[model samples]
Target: MTKITHFWAFFTFVAFSLGLSNCRTVKNGLDEKIYNG
Candidate 1:
């Protein structure tokens, strides 16, 4: 039971970090487009 809980916690952290990085990249892309146009 403890092992399963630990696995899930690590998985969630990884997913959250990935999501944040994706959002940052998307925001940067939008900023560049706005500036160029």
Candidate 2:
């Protein structure tokens, strides 16, 4: 049970980091479009 719980935490952290990076990329793209237009 403890091992499973630790794995779950690690998985959640990785997923969160990926999500954050994706959001940053999207935000930067939008900013660039606005700047160019």
RMSD of each: 0.4, 0.6
Candidate 1's TM-score reads 0.94
> What TM-score do all the candidates reach, one by one?
0.94, 0.90
Clashes of each: 0, 0
**Highest TM-score: which candidate?**
1
**Tens digit of per-residue lDDT, candidate 2, span 1-37:** 9999999999999999999999999999999999999
Ten residues in sequence with the least summed lDDT for candidate 1: 1-10
Worst 10 residues of 2 by lDDT: 1-10
Model 1, total clashes: 0
| Global fold similarity of model 2 (TM-score) | 0.90
Q: Which stretches of candidate 1 lie over 4 Å from their true place?
A: none
